[model samples]
Target: MNNKKENIRLLVSLGIAGVMVAGILFIVGRFSSSISKNAMYDPPSPLLPNSPFPEGVSLGAKILVTADKTADKEAGVQAFASNDFATAVTKFQSSLQSNRNDPESLIYLNNAKIAKSQVLKVAVIAPIGLTLNEAKELLRGVAQAQDEVNNSGGIKGLPLAIQIASVDKFDKIKELDDQFVKDSSLVAVVGFGRDEKIYNDKGLVRISPGSPTTQSRQDQTQSGQTRYVFYASPDRDNFTQAIAEYIVKKERRTNVAICLDSAQAERSQAIKKQYADFIAKAGGKVTDTECNLSAQNFRASDFITKAITDGAEALLLNPRPDKIDAAIDVARENKGRLALFGSQQMYGEKLLKFGQGDVKGIVLPVPWHQNANNNAGGNNSFGDKAIKLWGGQVSPRTAIAYDAMQVIIAGLKEGITRQSLQKALSNPNFSATGATGKIQFSPSGQRQGGVFLVKVEPCESSQSCSSSTGYNFVLVQ
Candidate 1:
């Protein structure tokens, strides 16, 4: 009888302890709820069904409910706010007990998943026959920007990865084209504006970092259109028109002459016709056209002699800066008494240095640079980050490269599949500090911004030339 009584007493004590423990747990749970509410700035009211998830779905809830909670919720929130997606993802995952249906957990989890898959792979294929040092530098800038973004906590915590494949300029055309076709992961292509047939693939989209010929080609579906290509730079038509207008409007000259070196006269003729129209719209005239650019003794004097003989008051040419030396020789031979105008091809520092007397009055349309203005439009935070991580040299292609990586990262965060990257690139809605300007695209694969007109100035006697206003280019307002 004494043993039975002792067993009963033990059972009674155990029941009382259990009740007391339950009471204490209930009070602690309420206290935790209050702290969570205060921390999140929660109001004492229920949310509407259409509103954002309740406070219960916040990181605080996950932290308080977890057995090994350790103030991870606040850290996760901070990470997310700073675009440090990777860190936020780690913290959120740590605070979750069962993240399956938790809205906040799911949001972070989805971002992490997309980021993991968004290891964007790109391949650059320049025209095999052209010597494109500028294009190479631009593409390199883009690659370096990707590296920087990847290192800085990545997009939504996914790392950025890029690969480049360059073809020798002397390689066979067929072999070069074959190489581009074989690589399947190539999300987009750059520096192939000269060859429409190379990038005419449905699965891939091409981004032209340089100016393609303005002359229309049969490969494209329509005039001034790139069927399978997205020109990060302005289309040849817009660029040429802008150049022609600058000569007439800014330089105060008329009677323009066109010097054509392209193979087919079709594109040149089209450009001439369009340029004449734009000039007329802007109130100007075209005096003549020169079909041959490789005439014997094509000296500055020869062209000027022809221009003076033809009553050419203003010359609109397309010779690159490297070729300006020969043109300058021709001009000096002719006594340097002629007004000249050229395309963006003649706006480099070399042209300003070597052809100062020959190209004094020359006008050309070029991309505007912010650095010319106390570095206002410089690659601010994104650009600085890219330069610091990559190297000391930040080229013009830096902005687009960073923007491209951001696009890839964003798509990955939003669960954009590989199949849709091409489409997304066709018309990405996000705004980013572009290398050129506010970088955005249109549905037809053209950059949706205007070009700028720049003037070349005489620097010194055969030294590297600088801009008159240090690239202080303004819109045609």
Candidate 2:
């Protein structure tokens, strides 16, 4: 079968799929009016002012205080000027009771509340019951990024803290996201797009740093100043295409075994179809099977046995990290006859620790490799700093989380308001250098760093191998 060389890139473009989410953003009045009591509409809230006694609150003057019959609105402004943001928030809320549309009160209320908080709060909703390394790496990347931001004075001078919502099933996403939306201080969130609740909740901006989906919530980005969702790759389609390219262009595996975790079967079914489509187009045969699942006993060995019976020349394993062992054991038993392959889910330290040295060359497709840029150790490079800061190599999952934080930080720099952050993230021109390299978003909220097919290798290897990410990235079109 003669495959078109350009089809590889085309598969990526056509299958650059993501599920867009929709949301709502609530904003107050328009910008400032000419020659009014205030020149700027939204001013800064003091970071816990030690002393009070300022006449007015202004950015240019940094002081503007006025009064009326119910000076709650005016008292709030005075407290805001004095850096007593806690008092300012009290008065602003009292002011809102009298007139909810009070632009001045609404603006300072949000500001005073944010200023009074101990840290800038954000949420990360990740599924639990996955492997420890999977959860650990994701959390570590986020924590490291938070440390970097807080060390540098944080966003709007507030330190950062991530509230992790760990769920067991994909269906658990919405329930937790709804909980985060209730907290007004929680401006943005990062997690799985498969969390369907994120699709329903229109109050907080959500982002899936790694999970991929078939639909997108791009409409949420258009919402003026409320909630929205954004994508950051590992979309099932991209991974399938990447693997397909590798099978057709590199290994020439004619009949490949495609297996899945019964627990993850429903979630992974669509991806299996995508794999089938891509490989068939490339003229490679796909032999598919579903895993054996029990409430207490689910083994990939049974799945592998089925693949061998079907006469598969290669194996593609898609499972949560915990189930990867079963597949590796089977692939190793068959040894030279059956090749092993996987998706981004397989890119972690656990693969090395658990692969039993049997998966030395199992191939996987990932979005970022430490050596993707071919830099030894640039001070600003994402991978190098992570290794230096954390004292371990950075995985693509960690890099993606780091990049997600970088994206939010970039959006924070654009402006502190929720609406500003959404627009900044969705801005077609806005691109940032993250630990994963240059990151830009598509119109549908997909990150620009495309997928790369990486071959699994030992955690420690020779100079001939690039083991930084515990694997070597094979060049493919």
Candidate 3:
């Protein structure tokens, strides 16, 4: 009887122990799964799964994500990820030799050579899947800056290694904030949509390469506080103010009609208000009849007719980048009936190509013009170098992206830590020379500089135009 009772007790105890162990494992599994889901790592290539590219090409891929499976670039990416820096260097070099216009390969090649050494790192988060051309343009600028710095002995002998992150949506930025902030080696981040407040709250230094939205100034209520966001381009207020001044004061157009996409109401409204305020201050008025270009069954001809009927002297075409066609339609409908004034969004090769003659004489504000001779009457060094490096023309996005990197590099010169670099940049005395001439930030962290105005003109026979459409953006004299 005693043996039986002892055996029963032992069995019960063993069963209880087993249950506890199972429970522990279940809890741990849940925790690990959560961590895996939220982990910030390089995203997989955005290429289609059914793409003809082979399997090995997917590993360690960044910009080479779009390259073919058998390409030297793909091999280099795989080798680089596997710590085979020697193979990576050779393959990337071979890839570049075949296609000199591949800035992505050039950047990756430079990064591979410095993989074994101590380096200063910065990341550029561009909308790759969303806007491939814009993303490439932005990357080219950073690539040029990286190539220049690495070739010139890098930042105080520490090679600059750039990491490229392609985000398709704005929410991805929020998901990345924590991981990026935890990265001690990453000194700064350039590019991304206008989500400065998110980065600022996380205490990460974010530089806007092309976003024109004005950021909040550091609140005086928080003593000794610093805002970590900085703008490398003009803010909307400054940009609109410049355009408004040129219209009301330069062009002397008192009544201007506004046309914008209703899909982007917030941005359009803000821009309209800013322009109206500036124009009103200068004794001008925005027309009462505003045109929503993205509205259903919208007719550009009817919009233009309404503006003219409402006593509008000039038309402010402020369409979203995706809605350039609508803006072009408006221009085509106008047919020189009213002066065309465009938002900076219209400044691109698309305008020259699609709008053609209709877009001619449209004045738009740009951060930099390639032919503007911004280097104090000398050669535009940035433009010249960009042409040689990419073997083609670059847009304002590239110039500003280069400037943003230059700003970060400037901060790195003072110190490499996040805090140290932020302090250096936040200092009122801090300044950096960029492709757009002198770069200085206001107390609000907005870029302090006058915006350049460019007008579309026919490419003269004697002059080389960057646009293949035989039209170019000439610096407005």
Candidate 4:
């Protein structure tokens, strides 16, 4: 009986040992499978799954990152050019992983973010009942660009997203406000006009390419809370100041005329006071200022005649659409005798209607060009690439808008937060190395300086009118 019992115990011990061995093998198999499935460090593939490039983005900027590892970067750029964003992104990712000491990688990474952000997830909440077609176009550009950035990979690992709510009027805006309050993914917003009160009420960050605060547009103080709201340009007074200075230097003329509608006329007068003071500082003169907003049958012939008679050598005219035509007519009549100077508003597609002949000798400052010196901003390729992306024809506002997007993306790549944005905007200075020249954001969020100047050139095969085109900086004279 004792022998039989010992045998039973031995058999049971053997069975337990066999089961333990099988269990160990099963665990080892699972561990190997997991590593194989998710291993990012496997013998680096020649190409990654997708180009690390962001989509719908065109940097046209040269790398500003450091120079030590140019080979890896060059390889990445080649991949990007070949439309292998995945491979490019992977190479960049690997380089970044190997060493975080490359500044060029930072630039490359930023570009990658821009391309990626386009592919990010985004939605739009455009204003309803837009007053003009241009507003709609502006909103469209913002939405499409945002959408492209978010779907790809966003900055770092964060995904980009947007939501759209259409509010036709005041009452409807109130309803949309309630909806906006509940959303969690809304990082920023672009509005139709400066409805700061409504924008602030919803905790939505606002950006407006066109201001509701422009002269005679509306009182921005109604929603004077600027903490969450940012502007693309300066307040009316500052913009006028930049224009005034450009006029004096580029034209080498002193006397100027200020013309506008009744409301805008009043604002123009106010701006004139500030500029007149600046003129004295610059050793220039603001001679013969004209403010006319309500001149229904007002003819430019008479105004030009009066300006010339008053000894005004340069005219600073800011009239409404019809008056703009009249002023150009008057300028045409003078023809090289009096130089016509116009406000920034004068640089638009509508000006094309005045006929190039009517606008020759007219000078204005523009915000965009094709081949600016590496004196603008970005990696020295911001302008031409933007033009190509815009299909050869682009507006000044378009370039500014693009730059604004760049600013946001840059901040994100640097670990974007609300605080980072404010830091960038406060004295935000982009080295002048691209198409738009050097861009500096003043404390107030205005592009601190101007690089663009406008001169009227004859339209193709036409003598009656001319188009306002941007000339090379060297060719401005």
Candidate 5:
């Protein structure tokens, strides 16, 4: 009887121990799962030692440090991240002494000074890791606006605080969506590639300064509708229509060849089709021959030969922004055999620098040009301010970004929340002064203006082209 009783007690104890072990394992599994999910959305801590901001912070080792230079800027970033604004200001000023052209450091220095008082926060989504130069141009515009606002007593006495979110890809924006939404102080977001739609769906006020891709006016949701997106640049349709109009009516070219990057088939095809439709309506035809610039076996000479054989009178080069070199190759091969036209992507310093004389006579539709402001009897106050701040010319991206921020600032005057800002911008009476002129948006959030056309020409001996290659994009008279 005693042995049997002992056996029963042992079985009960073993069963209880097994249940306890299972319970502990379940709790640990739940905890691990929660951490795994949070890890995907959480901003990664800075990899550099003693840096307080996340890795996505624009002013970190990933951006400021290189093999030869390391100390002041890095130290400034650490000080800024740790809330030592005074030390950060001193360190950044010292760092700028070495390189005054560094806009990243300049912006950080401005932010450190502004942090001493109440501030309204705004964020810019920059493609830092992917395209550093382009990202810098975008940031310069935002920085210029922030500097101007804060210096002039800020927006109703609250200084503007600028934050940078450097993203490598458009999809990476999704990872930041939750964090941005949670920050109630963030009034607006500027700059994105082709994926501003995510913010629109979430009802966040997003203004795209550089993206030419068009977005719909409204997004349908279960709770009725949302329309919190705005575009500062001209859409693809505007570009295609303008290019086609110029070719068919202005230049009188009836036969055209479409050359585009196959790797960016969606945007390329859309542009091709739109251009073709507009050309057809204006009495022109596009050659059926395929001119795939992204093809592995593509040759510019052979493509030009095929185009000539197909009775092409003009070539519409629609390569992706990154594939401008490929388009330049085609121009070199053509040797001005045909009239050349390009999309907005071609309007940059790269074309003048790399294409040189080969790209001369190429006409492009751009959002804003410095000459446009000059041609208007020196009316672009923003342009004058930018030149003074950066000590040189600024790109159309910078001009448009500056305008986007101006719009946000204008909206803030009506109210501070996202919903109030959206409502204010949506009103018909709303308008803001931009670099080029007055800025207004349509009901669909598109900029209410046509694009400017510019042509590449040789710089006169007396003219300062501001280009190393002696060619300049002069405003079309």
Candidate 6:
């Protein structure tokens, strides 16, 4: 009887302890100054049934300060709030040196290190004379990310800055590169077509050693400086491969018609080669067509008519944003029978503004989408904040560019130096969460997350798209 009584007493004590622990965690969740999150944030599945390939990466907001701040933690937080990441780092370090196991101290110390680092200043370059919406959208993402980070204690405490410039002449790439190189603050350039114009036969690259190939450029330097500028968009080879694979294996569309944007002939041609190579290897037929970007009212009826005659089941457009509408118009001109595919370059608001009821079943490989499946969207706190800040529709450019900036910010937290930044980028093993998905890079500096396919069609209301934003971007496999 005594032994039974002791067992009952032990059980009661254990149950009480469990309740206390839960209560502590609940309070922490509610009151932590900065809710700390791991590197990647993935929305709970089922809740995100709309996402096709839902296992991409996303950024999670985490706690940087604790409610029960120790003396050291309090001092560090004060310093952090004042933008003195250096002093905060010092205090955090002292606190850690005193108590090796203090969690808040360790966390604050990390925050201090990141905040004390150099500010990341990425250069945004576009064709001279205008603020290309894509570039502006990208900058907006960067700006939004910067504001969020700085407001939330920044990357340990350092904020991000951006510089916008124009490339008036392709031939003047060397001159432009030289001017950029003189500014040590400039770490990466987001635009600039990766064509020979920037690296002609004369080896016009100003960073020295020009380049060998996209595969080897990020690792090599000329005169101890970076030879390659990181690109924000998807790689040409990988992009074509993803689109081709989707059509061949998933969509099962065998006969494809290729349309090229004449204004972007060089880039389009490169992508076309990848498409042709993939299609041929897959034992599929591909027909080629050309479109012009300058045409105000583009109707590629000739191209569509010829493609249909050739038994092409799908039309793949390698065109600028202006041409996407034209491509859609021509497809509609054919009564919307053929499946349409495009690359990331095919982003525009007009698809919704005009092509709503007519443009359906159009598939494209984009790096980012306002996936309702993501925890950040679907009227979630992050998604609501994004809509309120940027207004209108959220373009893919904005999402990817914002994530790219986040990637650089994450890299700065590790160790702030050009070499550190480069290694973090060039290291294939390195990965982090962006607004879209998990982002990593290959040794060649190409981003490593798998491509996601979004299609336009009839859809119901969700956090990202509704009648207000026109059609929805359904994530198809």
- Best candidate according to lDDT: 3
Clashing pairs in 1: 299-330, 300-330, 300-331, 301-330, 301-331
Q: Which run of 10 residues does model 6 get worst, by summed lDDT? A: 53-62
RMSD in Å for model 4: 17.2
lDDT: the better of candidates 4 and 6: 6
Q: Which candidate is the best by TM-score?
A: 5
Estimate the overall C-alpha local distance difference test score of candidate 3. Answer: 0.77
Model 6 C-alpha lDDT per residue in residues 389-410, reported as the tens digit of each score = 5444466766766666666777
Q: Evaluate residue 122 in candidate 1 and report its C-alpha lDDT on the 0 to 100 scale.
A: 50
Clash count, candidate 1: 5
State in Å the error of residue 127, model 1: 6.6
**Reference-based lDDT, each prediction:** 0.50, 0.62, 0.77, 0.49, 0.75, 0.55
Question: Per-residue lDDT tens digits of candidate 1, residues 1-477?
Answer: 999999999999999999999999999999987554222221111211122322222211222123222455557656654556688778767754433212234333333333435344454443212433333445445555454555577545544433333343434434544554444434444445344565553334556665445432233436443345655666666777787777777767666666654444666576678778877777778766353455554444455667667776666666543355555554455453556656665544445445555555556665544243225544555445444544333434444444444445444444333335454565457444555556666655566666666554444556432244223112233
Would you list the clashing residue pairs of candidate 5?
Answer: none
After superposing candidate 2 on the true structure, give the runs of residues whose Cα lies further than 4 Å from its correct spot. 1-118, 126-129, 168-172, 193-201, 215-227, 264-266, 288-306, 459-477
Question: How many clashes in each candidate?
Answer: 5, 18, 0, 51, 0, 11
lDDT tens digits by residue: candidate 4, 1-477: 999999999999999999999899899889986553323122111222132322211221233222335556666766756656666666666765664434234334444544534322222334324322232334334433453455555566554433334444445544544443333333444443334555444444455554334432344333344444555543455555556776676557777655555545555566567667766665677656454646576665676677777777777666543345555665576676777777655665556555455666566655554434434444435544433333334455555554445445554454344434444444345322212444455444444444455565654443322123432112143
List, residue by residue over 1-477, the lDDT tens digit for candidate 3: 999999999999999999999999999999987554233322211212122322212213444337323388888888876778899899998987787766678778888888767677777776666556666778788889999999999876688877777666666766566556655556678876445555555556888886445224323224344677788987666678778889999999999999988776776686678788988988799998868888999999899999999999999998877678899999999999999999987887788988999988999999888877546536648988888788777889899999999998898788765666777888999999889888888776778887888899999999787879999888887
Error in Å for residue 270 of model 2 = 1.7
Q: What is the lDDT of residue 177 in candidate 5?
A: 64
Q: Rate residue 283 of model 5 by lDDT.
A: 90
Better of 3 and 6 by TM-score: 3
The list of candidate 5 runs beyond 4 A from truth reads 1-54, 59-71, 193-197, 211-224, 375-380
lDDT of 2 by residue, 170-276 (tens): 55665665555554545678777554444334435676776445434324344343335666664556677878878776788878877666565555666677788
* Model 4 CA deviation exceeding 4 Å by range: 1-152, 156-185, 195-202, 210-226, 234-243, 246-252, 264-266, 287-289, 320-337, 374-380, 412-440, 459-477
TM-score of 4: 0.56
